[model samples]
Target: MRSGKQADFAYQAVYRYMIDLINEVSPDVRVKLPSLRHLAERLNVSISTVQYAYSLLEKEGRVYSVAKSGYYALPVSAPASYCTDADLLERLYAGTRRPGMQVLSADEPAQLLSLDASLLQLERELLRRHPLQLQPYSQPCGIWELRTALAARYTQSATRCWQADDVYVGADLRGVLEILIEVLGLKGAAVLVESPCDWLILRLLRDAGVRVIESPCDESGKLDLMQLEHLLRTESVHLALFSSTASLPPQERPHAARLLEQQGCWLLENDIHGELVFDPSTHFLRDLVNPGRLLVFSTFEKFIGPEAPYGYLLSRHLSAPLQRQFLLRAFRLSPIRQRAIARLYQNGRLDQHLRALRTLLKEQAILMDGYLQRYLGARLSYSMPQAGATFWLCSTQTVDMRRVFEHLLARQVVIAPGELFSVSGLYPQHLRLSHVFNGNHSLDRVMEALAEALKYGRIG
Candidate 1:
């Protein structure tokens, strides 16, 4: 307890020191904070304490964080476009002033806003830059331009030796998984997955007759690493499907990354949310983990919604037979869409949008988290999703989330109950609330409904 107090004092001291240093810098100046470990050693405080202080500064808009990079000083008015806690809260509360405003809000947190308009904008840009050459037909491995663009993406941050054919661009998440199973002959193979996984991934493997083992999470919302270690040591597990960092608390990701690297299981990295992270310094296990045993894939749908729905699969170990199997089994995306995306990738317009989107995601997550605390208080439990637009929340077993779900559903708000996320109906007391708004409503209004749901336990 005394040491805890000491850590707190140290945290406050570090925070003050940071503010002082930041205040000294001019608006036009740019500076990088010492790395977390470096700052920890310098200040003689724990690394966790330094990390906490940095998070506080980021939330306050004094500093900017970059994933797989480092934190930097923010310019004055850096967060001008970001809605503040007060303004966002006011908007949410204003929505509650209306009659019958508690409709359920189903959280498709990963989807982008304005699908058709955005795609049309991309098409216009493509026409402006390149001659219109939309092919009538394309290859099974997808159009070369897009595949090559995706291959170039894989090499940008981490040096994973990837070539054009190494990427297969087509299909949704399930479709790609089916092709992987067929290509790798994973039928009846023992594959390890973390429990409380995305229902789609879990159900896909189980339904396919693959021997699926669910390694449970500990209270910290991280893999019960001991169990994972045991499974790796004892079980005949050929692959470990770590769905995404969104499934676990953010702070524990480094540990998970380390485990995946050392555990020796063939790694399947689903990096759908990799680009949507708040922390610019953030690095997904897909990039951090050893790439030799790595197979990576994600859909453009994760970024842009189902309007285009272009997706790609990348792997260096794509053998000749496997390549042939992929070519036959997988279909290519539309040529025009592929060409437009390839142009965006090459021109850096798409990358700029993604970077802005990441900032928006982080800002919204923090604001809505504040609302959650104010509305539900300790009655609800959750961690801010490391990389997406929704908060993965839990409540006590006594609180029937289904009743809340029903209550919200009656009002036409379609929130995703946690049970829907798992095949076996785990997280009955859990639910997902999205921070992204499509102009129909806002999060503050959603918080009001959730608070009301808690107040009347028998609403169903």
Candidate 2:
């Protein structure tokens, strides 16, 4: 009904209004926009004007239309300044790759390059016994056969003499921790956590409403016993969660354990990476503390493949309560997976796999450390881990870690910033690099990119 000039002016006005509305609302992706008629009425424009505006937005990839539904807003690509550390972490984990992108951010072990002949044989055996081994539902605690085998392995290793009853298998370490957090009534209680601890666990404690107190450790990752003692004496600390083997070197572990035991606070030891240690005798942490005061949990997902997602907790005191919580939570693990793992352990295949994995991890870690030294040298400082695959790295005083993180991210080499690990945005000059996921083939390229990024500061 209008002239072309009038229509164009009307559409432009409607477009400007829509842009202002989008800026005001900041809608999420797939969020429905106002209906065409509604938008036209609000803008005091013709329906054609609104349609024209929507068409322009769609062409610009700012909106999408669904059949029988109204237009929906596409996720706005905000400027990097608006992105938070958590957002950057999520992008890294989502594996957003650009051309020439080399990801160094993953914490998982590298995919097995080739099939192990022994593992293949085990797989064939598993397939042959598939139907016979299948069960309707897993036991509330877990498959008893797996628990018994794990108990025997623990006893043989001299870690602790755990009976099958004391070992309760769960979906994963996180799930086990959740159950423990609820059952132990950790809500609103003061919980002690190590500085630069596991970020995921720190988030878990916060979400559970626990007052998290950081117990700062020394350069060697050993808890300061005097400070910890002072905290224990002053504050009503409920529990202290830490990595016994991974964080504390062997010689320091017994003393640390003794200190923890004397404090009388409940201890939760994370041994998820204990099995991958190059030297088992010096890296073990089970025998130091009394089981009465400590509850230890470890995951097979790190050693065995992620496909076999199960973790076990050893605690005579809390096993019954954990089991009750598991029942209430309906946290049923897969019997088939449990049976497969138990078969691997029973036939010694698991031990062979572990030995091979440890060797591979050690090689990868050495390669990564060498690359770091070659690339960054004095600009970046780090202590090589004794047991785990991750290196805790810090930037020198001259280097800005935030700028370094931005540079590496731009280069498509994603590394976890140290800010993600702390409760109070501490350790801005730090990074955590895991060499386990990326193989040696990518290491050279990653180092080259890292060196370039560091040298150039921030690149387009």
Candidate 3:
């Protein structure tokens, strides 16, 4: 007796009920469903509602109907096997032997800037000025002074408008990303990541149960907008996580941002190496994307060396909710470290350190590139270092990357294989080398080992 509109709702409800009943029954076993009239009478709905519900189940393959007989349940599909590539990479990295190893694998900066007497003195003075900060736990969003300083710095440097409340501090970029993922409710959602991205982040997304769609990039590390647009048009991607400055140059970012925004996708820009820009007029995503749809992340660990533990996230859309969730989860960063970093920024010491670090890294990159080209010749190809300390190298089809990696590992020279960066295991003939971690003299040894590996297929 229900009306047409009410019958639609009744059918949907009955559809769910029938699905539950079908699931409870044994697979491949025929369960005779009640007739349309009988179901309508039992559920106190019209016969059309019952028929609509049964038709839905039939369409979904959850049940099938014979010409004259009743409907029967279908067997549910089994779950797919889990991929262990990330776990394998994790174990391989942990088992890496570091004793007397000329490590060219880490993305850490080459030289740590020596703190001058004035900077050391200032740190002591700040600690004395605020002894209470060292006594108890700090705020979950981190020390306000540091956040304010960071906001001011971003506004001044990038010409992006920001407030202190827009910043959230965390232990590191990974921890902050985890929190961001949770706050944005991205678990099990489709996320588009640039192919050959940071390996750790790829693993994180996989572990979070999200459907990861890898968008391929060009030789220069820039994302292919055409392919990205194709995916956006085809897939239900919720977020696009990518590096802010690496791979793609400044000019291309705005166009890419426009494409993403048009498709209503959120952008998570990881600007970890934004401070080491070789170009003076480089533009960041903050200047391109709508702040309401963007989340920018950066860390001192890349610029100030890996010893620096502090990192910050800036997002006008998610900051308030992120802070609430951060506090609710009882996450706290070290107050002392926060104050120390703030002091560096407050006194312009961080800028001074950055100038020196950039010069050193640029010099080292040139040296490493020269050595690589000189030693390996036509066997390997790599692009010049632009922003970050790492170089992405592609080997010729004749060379086997696995053999080269094993050869280097045997010589106590650990190098990151290109396969680790790809989810589909596409880059079997590529490698990633970090110039900042190894000195010029040690790099000479790396070249020697690589040349030997190329010639003899082993390093002994």
- Model 2 segments more than 4 A misplaced: 1-88, 94-100, 110-124, 156-160, 398-400, 437-442, 455-460
Assess each prediction's global lDDT (C-alpha) against the native: 0.64, 0.66, 0.68
RMSD of each: 21.0, 13.7, 18.3
lDDT per residue (tens digit) for residues 296-393 in model 3: 88877677643354567988776578978777645444455567778889889888887887787788789788888888867777778777677888
**In model 2, what are the clashing residue pairs, if there are any?**
none
Score residue 209 of candidate 1 by CA lDDT: 75
Q: For model 2, what is the alpha-carbon lDDT of residue 257?
A: 72
The TM-scores, one per candidate, come to: 0.69, 0.75, 0.75
State the weakest 10-residue window (summed lDDT) of model 2: 110-119
- The TM-score of predicted model 3 comes to 0.75
lDDT of 2 by residue, 1-460 (tens): 2343233246667777776665554433335789978987787765645665675565333555544576655244432233345544434432232334455554555243222344435545655676555533637777888889878876743445778888887766656777888888999999888788776678778778889998866666666767877887788887887875655656767876777677778888887777777776654555677667877788776676544545678777866678888787554454555676788889887777777777887887898788888887866777767766677877664455556767776766777777778787777767778776634346777777766655565333
Error of 1 at 22 (Å): 58
* 1 against 2, candidate with superior TM-score: 2
